[model samples]
Target: MQNKLRIIGGAWRSRNITFSDAPGLRPTPARVRETLFNWLHYDIAGKTCLDLYAGSGALGFEAASRGAKSVVLVESNAQVCLSLKNNVAMLSAQQISIAQTEVSRFLAATAQGFDVVFIDPPFTKDLVPTTCLTLENNGWLNPHAKIYIETERSLTLSGLPANWQVLKHKTAGEVAYQLFERG
Candidate 1:
């Protein structure tokens, strides 16, 4: 099956994109995305971004539309990756690229640093802590990089890096989303 979502802001505002109905894939809700982008309005332009567990490519696409210099979307599923590639081509998004690989593998091998990163892994797999640690321990983030994380409401965000400070947090329905700034 295919599902559709709209880009709520930036140059591609109101444009709709499609995604495969892959298991464990939940695109960030529009309201949550709106809030996140608003919080990042001043920081997005000309920035490099990483969207781990890219899923529907919502966050990545949004960043690109908003003027991020580059956006790399990492998704393990082939179908999802295809959808993301299609959208990138459809939008002629020169700044966006799709990586068809597991998040951990991509993180381990990534050599470049990003100014912003979006991490919205599948629920109940306990992937966030390890992913956070890898991003911190490795040289994946530029100084003062902004990280956005979305998880189920019940998931406790523990063991995150000490230098990361929560700049914003909000809950909508079952999802809890936050913006953290790397010190």
Candidate 2:
């Protein structure tokens, strides 16, 4: 089975993209995306972005639709990666690239810095802290880059980089999302 999501704004607004019904693949809700993008309104255009754990490619696609210079979506599942590639082709999104690999492995090997990054790992895996550390320690973020994270509402966000400061936070139902800036 497949699930579809609509791009709520930008050039692709109201366009629908499909994703496979894979386990642990939860796309960011439209409401949360709307709020996140609002927070990123001024920063997204012409920026390079990394969408780690790019399950459904919602965040990355949204960034590309909003005029991001480039977007990298890293996901390990073969089925999900295929869906992401198809969507990229469907949109003719020259700015988006899909990296088929584990989030940690991709972070370990890539040194390219990005202006923005979306971290929405599978719920209850406790992946955020370590992933954030890897991104910071491996020089994967540009100076003063913006990082967005979505996690289970109860997950405690600790062990993150010392210089990262929370800029915005909100909870809707079972999810808690936040935006952070590298200081």
Candidate 3:
């Protein structure tokens, strides 16, 4: 269980969100989140982002804090969604929005494409690859959008969209980070 959550950078530099690891939750570590955004958003200002499976909304709020023009965080679980809403309100991030729906539903509903899409589904279920496929199938992504994928290091991905290719891949502890773009 993580006791402290942090904003990666920007106006809320040292801000912390107290996170308790409830069932099916593992918030990304501060260092990893910071590094992930740094690589993905060379200059995130004015960019739009969608954070799928936004556990705790850590990554989504991080983008908004860093000056993303619009950031949406989607979560289905009622309890988690409530907490996510509270966190978003607490941060008072005008650019941020929260949707109470699973990733698939949100993807199916939103026609708004994003410059960056951060996918950090539950690691235990190993849903990262399926989520990636669904996103492409549901047309949630722009042709040139960048993806930040996090998954357990042991999972192997297959059947990726032909045009989607990895730009950078790395592992920190159990979290594997893959930065992907169109081929």
Best-fitting candidate, scored by lDDT: 2
Clashing pairs in 1: none
lDDT of 2 by residue, 1-183 (tens): 889999999999999999998889999999999999999999999999999999999999999999999999999999999999999999999999999999988887949999999999999889999999999999999999999999999998999999999999999999999999999
List candidate 2 segments past 4 Å from native.
none
Q: What's the residue-level lDDT of 2 in candidate 2?
A: 85
Query: Considering only N, C-alpha and C atoms within 3 Å, which residue pairs clash in candidate 3?
Result: none
> How does model 1 score by TM-score?
0.98
Candidate 1, run of 10 with poorest lDDT: 104-113
How high is the CA lDDT of each candidate model? 0.95, 0.96, 0.79
Per-model TM-score, in order, reads: 0.98, 0.99, 0.91
Runs of candidate 3 exceeding 4 Å displacement: none
Task: Specify the poorest-scoring 10-residue window by lDDT in model 2.
Answer: 103-112
User: Please, what are the lDDT tens digits per residue for candidate 1 over residues 126-148?
Assistant: 99999998999999999999999
> What lDDT score goes with residue 135 in model 3?
76
For 18-103, candidate 3 gives per-residue lDDT tens digits of 55456777888877887887786674678889888887788888888888999988888777777777677777878888888878
Q: Which candidate order results from sorting by TM-score in descending order? A: 2, 1, 3
